[model samples]
Target: MKQLLILGCLFISLGLIGQSEEETEIKNTINSFFSSFHAQDSVGMTSVVSKNVVLQTIGANKQRQQVLRQENFNDLIHAITSIPDSIKFEEKLLDYSIQVDGPMANAWTPYEFWLNNTFSHCGVNSFQLFKQEGQWKIIYLIDTRRREGCANQP
Candidate 1:
């Protein structure tokens, strides 16, 4: 009985280790994407993203009505690259919750967007990734943006 219990525990430990490793890899992939985004490096950003990736956003319009917007990947790249050197922006990730099942994984990240050293908005980003040819690549990304419920908001 003791030997059987030990063997079972060993297998469980191995499985947990594998899961932890996968989670770390997924987090790294997302981090790489954000690093490229902050640098405005389109090439670097594309390296970790699938060619057919989808992007979307949920936010409020001028009248405070909620709206969903779908963005073309190429257009997003162009917009990022077109930013002037005088402007600075960042998405500060507050927390990450990731789950993996086989070749698919989802990462939920809450973040605060800052522009030119001022708080702009806060939201949560949902990133879906796939393990393609042994490498994790982002397949879909969506986020919510709101001026309320921000940590630093007055």
Candidate 2:
């Protein structure tokens, strides 16, 4: 009976380890997605997104309403690449909660983007990720954008 108890404890420990590994993998995948954006690595970013990925950016501009697809990925890549390296877009993850179910997962990452070390905008990014063929990929993303202040609007 003692041997059986030991075996059961060992099995439980292995199961917990496996769960921790899976969580780490998912977190890494999400981090990679953000890293690609910061590096302006268009190809790398594209690789993490699904072909049918839906991207939405909400702000005061109409141009932000367009849906992004694989066909226009290059254009988006070029746009990001055009930003001067001196001007940085940093996303600080304030809080994030992720849930995984079978092949689907959803994550909410509250972030603040800084420009040249100054807080420029802040928003929350909602992501829809899918584990397809054993790899996690972002299938959809919607982010809200707001300037620091608008009281002085013209």
Candidate 3:
């Protein structure tokens, strides 16, 4: 009985170690997504996301009415690379909180957007990812943005 209990604990410990490694990989995937975004490389960005990925933004309009907006992924990608040379943009991520279960993972990141190196907005990005064919890819992403309470990460 003692030996059986010990073996069971050993297996549980190994499983947990593997789970943490998966969490790390998921986080790396998200980080890579941001890296590609900052570079304005649409192809690079697409590599980290699913083909049917859904993107949405939650924010308020000029009248202070809340709005939930969904965007076309491919159009957004095209728009990113088509931005005129006059403006520069960067979305700085503050921190990440990741959770994983089996083949699914969720990453929550707080971020601040800068346009031409000037503060623009701040929000939290929630990414739902799946381990498809042994690699993590973002499938759904929703974020909240507000003009106030932005963090000074510098």
Q: Every model's Cα RMSD, please?
A: 0.7, 5.1, 2.2
Ranking by TM-score: 1, 3, 2
TM-score of each: 0.98, 0.74, 0.88
Give the best candidate by lDDT: 1
On residues 70-115, what C-alpha lDDT tens digit does candidate 3 reach at each position? 9999888888888887899988888989889889999999999999
Better of 1 and 2 by lDDT: 1
lDDT of 1 by residue, 1-154 (tens): 9999999999999999999999999999999999999999999999999999999999999999999999999999999999999999999999989999999999999999999999999999999999989999999999999999899775
Model 1 residue 64 lDDT?
94
User: How do all the candidates rank in terms of lDDT, highest first?
Assistant: 1, 3, 2
Clashing pairs in 2: none
C-alpha lDDT of all candidate models, in order: 0.96, 0.76, 0.91
Candidate 1 ranges with C-alpha deviation above 4 Å: none
Which is better, 1 or 2, measured by TM-score? 1
